[model samples]
Target chain A: MIFLKFLLYVWMVLVLLGAFFYAPLAKGLGEYTRVMYFHVPMAWITTLTFLIGAIYSILYLRKKDIRYDYYSETANQLGLLFALLATITGSIWAKMSWGAFWNWDPRETSIFILLLIYAAYFALRSAIEQQDRKAALSAVYDILAFVTVPFFIFIVPRIYSSLHPDPLINTQGKVTMNGKMQLVFFNSLLAFTMVYFWMLKNKLEVIKLKMKLKQLES
Target chain B: MIKAYYIFRKDLLQEFKTRFAMNAILLFAVVTLSAVSFAIGTFTARQEVLSALLWIILFFSSMSGLSHIFVKEEEAKTADTLKLVASASAIFLGKFLFNIVLLFLLEIIVVPLFIALMNFNVQNYLLLFFTLFIGSFGLAGGGTMVAAIISKSGAKGALFTVLSFPILLPVLVSGISATKIASQEQGWMTAYSELQTLFAFSVVIITASILLFDFVWNE
Candidate 1:
């Protein structure tokens, strides 16, 4: 685990360096293209974490396991964090490229909706006082929220011609990135996903420890 | 399904008797419509803005009272009785249908008043009707399920809108776009994709709600 953590550290550092120095800047975008390496991966991790969160929520519902609730809750909170990062990073990039922090672009609107959906998740969790009831209701909510995600991320954004950059895999069915960019980009995705899972694992451990301490006190 | 219908009828009968949900939503719709038309008097707002305004009125009006289908059951302590009598899915379906009827009633009154008051011109009545109809299904589907979820929580009123808004956004977006097209175009083909989106959204939301209702209803 320690070795894996060390590797993650090196991998992220190398990806950052490659994003700046190794990857060739693209036409028109120049230095701003580097934001894609971090921003895109953060967005990818946001979706990935939310997907995992929903999956575990289904598991919790089926198995009636408190541990699964912990997993689902932790994954969801991390997903929200990464989503916030993705939005802030994308906003900075937007300000640079579009001359404003927000343009109400299709992509921006969808992510903002995702933020609201998960924020509602937390609000729902906070409102329910009982443990089991909170877990059950929230798991159901997570699943319902996940069902709408595809519409927001995939469908709604595509319904309008967007100010956001063409996706990595554009409508023309082309991978826009060249070789070194792809290498760095994929590595960044891998690094961030690894970091998310690592954080999820540690957070779950802390949750378990806290539960144990609560049980002892009781 | 029969039980579901019975549940729907029971709620509808109660609704007609008390008229709580109907009155709340109708009052909201009328007030909002009058305020909007009074504000934009004789301005001849653009088709796009008018279409968006219609949906905004419908959305907020539904938000005012749609959650009552579940919140009422919980508050009156009839939720437990309903649970004993009906399966979770049946209860959900019944409430879903009741909410749909309530939404339609709100639309019947508001849409006409909105048009008359704002002088809104809808070129394709069929397209506009289909958009509003399917959009109401989406709203009630999402609204019923969310109301069930939040009815279990301590804060019901505020949480219902917060929870349902994001879920219902696709419906609103597609509905507004379709209404915009309906205002300018003469055929359904022009707004084909928007109608398809509204249809798909309603199907997805309702199906997911039914499948997940067991958890929220029982627990």
Candidate 2:
């Protein structure tokens, strides 16, 4: 426990330091660049959480495990929260750069749709009273919906030109960032991933406890 | 295959016996089109405007048809019985085909009334027909799956649109685009890719929903 706390503190410190330098570092590029440090990391974290949720969903379907279902739910809830943050940050950045809060650009539209799909996921879960059915149906939808994520996020957007910038971090490594920018970006990514795991662990524990209490009552 | 056909026939027969579903859909379509026509003054006066107006009518009218898809089953408590005997795939196919038929009938009435009321000439009748057909298939296919999920929620009508519209964005985009292009009598190649995209979307969504239906319905 002590070691975990130490690690979390270290992670938080790194995140704060990265954020502190974001403006000065992004200044070398342009005024609008500050958004990338926060927006990109948040978007990455959200997508990572969504992927985790999709995996848990598949596991729940295969094993019929309630714990997996809870884990999936927790990830989905957190994913939605972060996705909203990503959208807001991106929108703010867009307004600064393009003088528009909303545009029908493919990326913007796709992310909005992605958010709505997950919203409907929760809605579908709530409408069903039976716990097992809710788990099963949500699992199926999650898997199916995730399959479309690539199409919406990648394929469709690339098909049409858009104002949104491509990723600085590519498969091969940093795209064109200088050494300093790379260091800060990498640190931010690591810190955010740690934060995501920490939150997920706590959220799953709470979910387990709630389910236990519910079971006891019945 | 034969069993699937039997299920389809059974649904149609049952619907006809009561005439409730068909009557509700047809009346709603006619009344809504008439109201819109009256509001627009005359159809021919604004050809481009009429084209868009026609799609809006079809979209909203389809919503009413989709909302009650499973309401009667739940009320009558026949859903469980149906589930026990009929394959999930069969049920989905039957319901999907039924929706297509109902939507087709509604469109037949609505489309003509739209042209006549709006006084818009369909330059390429065949292209217009094709776009409408493909667009309807995409809508019905997607709407049927969502309706099944929503039906289990016990929240019908407007709730259906709330749950469905997001998933239906791509369909809406392609539908409107195709309608616009076809109304202008654009060449098939010009809109062919968009049409194919819509068709592919229908296939993918239907297949995914069918595979996932057992998980949803059994629960």
Candidate 3:
């Protein structure tokens, strides 16, 4: 585990260096396009964590095991954290590119909706006092919230003409990035995904330790 | 299905006698509509703005009362008794139907009042009707399930709207867009995508709710 952590630390440093130095300037975006290396992967991680959260929620419901509930809750909280980071980073990028902090771009609107959905998840969790009920209700909510994600992320954006740049894989199903930039972008994505799993693993371990401590105290 | 029908009829009969949800929904719609029309008097807002405003009112009004479908049961301690009598899926369907009927009755009043007061003109009434019809199904589908989840919580009143808004946004987004097209005198083809989205959203939410209701209901 220590070796894995060391390797990830080195990997992320390399990815960061690649983002700043190795990636070439794009046609119009110039230096601002480098934001893609961080922002896009964060958004990607946000989606990944939420999907994982929903899957664990299903597992929790099926098995009625508290461990899956802990996993689901941890995943959702991380998802929310990453989503906020993505929104903040995207907003900063928007101010640079679109001359305004927010244009209500379809992407912005969808992310805002996503933020609200998960915020409501926490609200629901807080309102329920019983532990089992909180776990069950929140698990159900996590699944329901995820069901709407495809519509928000894919369909709603398609409905509106977006001011955001074309997705890395555009509608015609092509990778717009050149060879070198593609390498850095994929590397950044891989690095960030690794970071997400590391964070998840650490968070789960912390939760497990907390539960064990509580049992000892009781 | 027959068990579901009985549950629906029971809720409808109780609703007719008390008119609690109906009155809350209707009053909220009327007040919001009047405030909006008064605020924008002679403003002649664009069709898009008017269409969006109409949905905003419907969305808030639905939020005002939809949760009562389940909250009332929990408050009265009837939820457990109902669970014993009818299966979870049946209970979900019955409440879902109740909410749908209430929303339809709400539109019957609010839609006309909204158009008259806001000077909203819809050249394609059929498209407008279809949008609201399908949109209400989506609203009720998502709203009923959320209502079930929230009713079990301690903070039912405030949590209902907070929980339902995001889930209901897809319906609102498509509803507003389709209403805009209908008001602009566009044909059915122009609004087809939005209609399809509303239909799909309703189907997906209801199916998921049915599958998941057992967990919420039994526990």
Candidate 4:
């Protein structure tokens, strides 16, 4: 528990430092570049969360364990939050750079669509009253939707010339980042991943507690 | 395969009898076209604009087709019965085929009306049809899956569009791009590759939905 608390503190400090320096860095590089620190991290975390959600979904399907379902649900909820943040930050960047908050560019539009798809997943879960069916159905949807995420994020955008920049983390040695920028970029990535795991742990614990309470009452 | 065909035929026959899906989709298409045309006011009207308008009409019309799929089943309390008799894959295939046919019918009506209203001409009718056909397949496949999921929700009609449009973006972009190329009278060899991409998309989505349907439905 102490170790977890220490990790949480470290994550919080990293996030604050990243957020603080992101603006000055943007002003230094260009207004559009500021989005790289925050928006890109959010986008990366969203993908990471979705992948983690998909893994838990598979485990839930295989084991039919309520705990795995809780984990999957927590990851999905957090993924949606990060996806929304990515969209908002991207939109703000677009307004500054492209002079429009929402252009129907392939990347922008595809991410927006991704957000909607996951939001529907949650909506579907809430609408169903049966617990077993909700977990099974949502698990299936999560896996299937995660499969399509690559098509939307990578393939669809590549098919068209997008205003959004190409993958900064590329195969050919990190897409040419300077030392200071790399420090900030890699640190933010690590910080966000830690925060995501922290949130997932807390959320899953809460879900398990609720289930225990319900069983006790019954 | 025969069971799938039977289910598909039954859906088509029932739809023909009631005209619920067809009428809703056609009316929605017409209204959307009229609204967009009115908004554009003919000053900035061009073939590109007209093509986009036709696609928007088809996109919105698809939502109606999607909603009608399970709404009709739910209204009659026949969804449970259908589920017991037919596998989820069969039901998905049936609904997907029905959506494709419905969208095709709407396209037949709306595309010409759009051309007349917007003064657009098709330079390559065959290529345009191929593009539209493949694009509609993707839309119907993904849309039917989403519709099934959303059907369990309270506000299904609204939920269908909200869930589908984003998931449908890849096909929409490819469809619009293919249509533009076809409209330019491009050679078959040139358009063939893009057509292949769209076909691959449709196939993958349809298969994925089929494999995943039981989980969604059983749940």
Tens-digit lDDT track for model 3 on B60-178? 99999999999999899998889889889999999999999999999999999999988999999989999999999999999999999998888988988899899889999999999
Model 2 clash number: 5
Q: What shift in Å separates residue A134 of candidate 1 from its native position after superposition?
A: 1.2
lDDT for predicted candidate 3 compared with the true structure:
0.92
lDDT of 4 at A141: 72
Q: Which ten-residue region of model 3 chain B has the weakest summed lDDT?
A: B185-194
In angstroms, the error of model 1 at A184 is 1.4
Report, to 2 decimal places, the DockQ of model 2. 0.43
Error of 2 at A139 (Å): 3.4
| DockQ in order | 0.83, 0.43, 0.83, 0.43
Candidate 2's C-alpha runs over 4 A off are A19-29, A167-174, A211-218, B42-52, B119-124
What is candidate 2's lDDT per residue for B74-163, written digit by digit as tens? 778899998887888888888888888889998888888777767767767787888788878878877887777776765566567766
Best by the TM-score measure? 3
lDDT of 4 by residue, A1-218 (tens): 88978977876687667656642553345646756778888999999999999999989888888779888888888999999999998899888889999989988878887888888788768876777777887787777677677778877776777887667654364456666677777777777777777778888888889989999999
lDDT of 2 at A91: 95
- Per-residue error for B101 in candidate 1, Å, reads 0.8
Error of 3 at A7 (Å): 1.4
Clashing pairs in 4: none
- Which residue segments of model 3 deviate by more than 4 Å? none
Model 4 lDDT, residue B189, Cα: 73
Candidate 2 lDDT over A1-218, as tens digits, reads 77987987987787667666642554445666767777888889988999999999989988998889989988999999999999999999888888898887887988898899899888878777788877886787787677667656765565456778775544456466667777777778777788788888888878879989999999
